[model samples]
Target: MQTCKILQDISALQVLSINISRRCFYTTTTTSPLPWLFVGLGNPGEKYQGTRHNVGFDMIDVLAKSHGISMDRVHCKAIFGQGLISDVPVFLAKPQTYMNLSGESAGPLAAYYKLPLSRIVAFFDDMNLPCGVLRLQDKGGNGRHKGVRSLIHHFRGNSEFARLRIGIGRPPGQMDPKAFLLQKFNATARERIDVGLQEGVGALKLLASRGLTESARCFNKEQKYKHIRVQTLET
Candidate 1:
């Protein structure tokens, strides 16, 4: 698994060098408030559903359901919906270029919408934390996540985009991370995972309305999801 991650990092660097011109022109004019782009990374296809790696897509579904955003339109190599979440206009995107090439979709979508990297959120699963936990950050490196690596690569190594990482926990001893990521959540962990997903949606909503500091406080403290209490939570 570690070897695979290293290879992915090398591959990303190579791709980043060639895709340096992914940035697009932007217009200064605007009538409405700037929109937010929430990107959920996952491989396309029903076979991938319910897998650890696809948790981002699962929560994106939760967000879209809560906001009444229909994600039927395809654009910029992703399926997305534009609508308001907590009265904040937002776009929820699921990239179809698979996991490692997420930026092939996300980068262009952000460019087309003229949304700055600061307002974009990358939601994905994290093995660094235990299940039933979450970590919301204003910005940071992707660690070893190739999907995020791809985004950073396309953004010219800029990790300024916000990220919401749902803790799926590391694979059990001696397991390959790739196999672990592709496995479906079993009954044993389902409850905790579901709870974490719910809390993640709340954290994401707060991020859209209340800003990163508060959202991080609500999501990323050492206590994690089990004990933290957040006020005025809606989205």
Candidate 2:
């Protein structure tokens, strides 16, 4: 998973701003206004696909399917597509820089499109809640998430952007959280994830129509009553 190497690189560049490789992520034919940039965080390659850590990627796939987003172009170290959601133009991205350097892929894309931090929505897995429970927060601290910490650093310490948090539950027994993130979901977990992903699809639509506050309130309220178990992560 290159997890060790990513950790080393993060430490080396902890205080330094390094040049990132350029990628051609944009090929939009939209004459309409740019819709919100929805970035799904995950590692690249087959081993990572369908794993708990790739829930963001899975959500991107769901959104693209429901909204006709092709995700045909690879740029900025991500594969993305432009499509309309209920008449709103939106860009979907799945970053290819593993997981720890997601900010490197997202920051440049934001600059490329001249989009403000407020216009971006980051969707990633969260370990705090049971599987299938989602948290929609306007802004908050990274809670020590390494990928999110990287984004905060790259954004010049700004953490005001919108976030769509999907719960993946905690590790079982004493298993390493890192290992848990890479493992694919079990059958029972997948059954529940399908439900959560449907909610996530609805949540994204709500974000496009309703503002962030209303959307968060609409989705987060369900978590209080629903007791679900699932696995996912965003580090």
Candidate 3:
């Protein structure tokens, strides 16, 4: 899909050389707030659709719904909603390039906009946290995620961007991590995913408007749904 004309003034049009080549993706002719990019990491194609690893995409979908945003048909990209969060234009994207190569789509988009690494927020699934839990961090190591690793590589190992991680639970004993991520969410786990999705949506908005630290503080207290811990008397 082509970019909207509003985005042209931001250097994306020049980066793609649309004027000289006449080959443009989309054109938006509107003014907007400082452009911020949101990348939801996941594998491409129907086969991986709705899988646990696609929680990032799923969360973005929820965010769109909450804000009345719609996805526009862009070439090789699932993009939609050029609207305001705190009156700032935010671009939402789910890379069709699939996980592991997410940077292939996001890296260029970031460069084209001349956006600081700090302005990019990557939403993705995390196995370390318990199901229904959410965490927002400024930056960190990939922690065994190939997709994140690829993004880090494309950005030349800069982890200064914000990350919103949604827990997808861990694999059962002896199960392959890749296989598990590709698996659909179990019936019992659906509730947690729903709750996490809601929290993720809220966190995304807060992150976009307020900043990462504020969002992190708001979401860090969401562990109540994961499980309740109690003290016991020792004999």
Whose lDDT is greatest here? 1
Error of 1 at 211 (Å): 1.7
Report the poorest 10 consecutive residues by lDDT, candidate 1. 226-235
Clashing pairs in 2: 25-75, 131-230, 168-232
lDDT of 3 at 61: 82
Backbone clash pairs for candidate 1 read none
Model 3 has an lDDT value of 0.76
Off by over 4 Å in 1: 1-32, 222-235
User: Per-residue alpha-carbon lDDT of model 2 for 1-235, expressed as tens digits?
Assistant: 6999999889877534332212213332435444689988888999888898899899899989988779899978889898777667688999888789999988888888778888888888888878878888888888767777767777788998888887788899999999999999999777767788888888879878866788878887876556432222332
CA-RMSD of model 3? 8.9
Q: Which is the better candidate, 1 or 2, if ranked by lDDT? A: 1
* TM-scores of the models, in the order given: 0.80, 0.81, 0.79
Those runs of model 2 whose alpha carbons end farther than 4 Å from true positions after fitting are 1-34, 227-235
Q: Model 3 over residues 1-235: C-alpha lDDT tens digits?
A: 2565567666875766657444322333334345678888987778988899999888778887788777775523545455566655677888887788888877877876678988888889999876667778888889888778878888988978878888887898999998989999887677878877887877777777777788778777665434342111111
lDDT (C-alpha, whole model) for all candidates: 0.83, 0.81, 0.76
How many angstroms is residue 135 displaced in model 1 relative to the true structure, after the best TM-score fit? 0.8
Indicate whether candidate 1 or candidate 3 has the larger lDDT. 1
- Please state every model's RMSD to the true fold in angstroms: 15.7, 15.2, 8.9
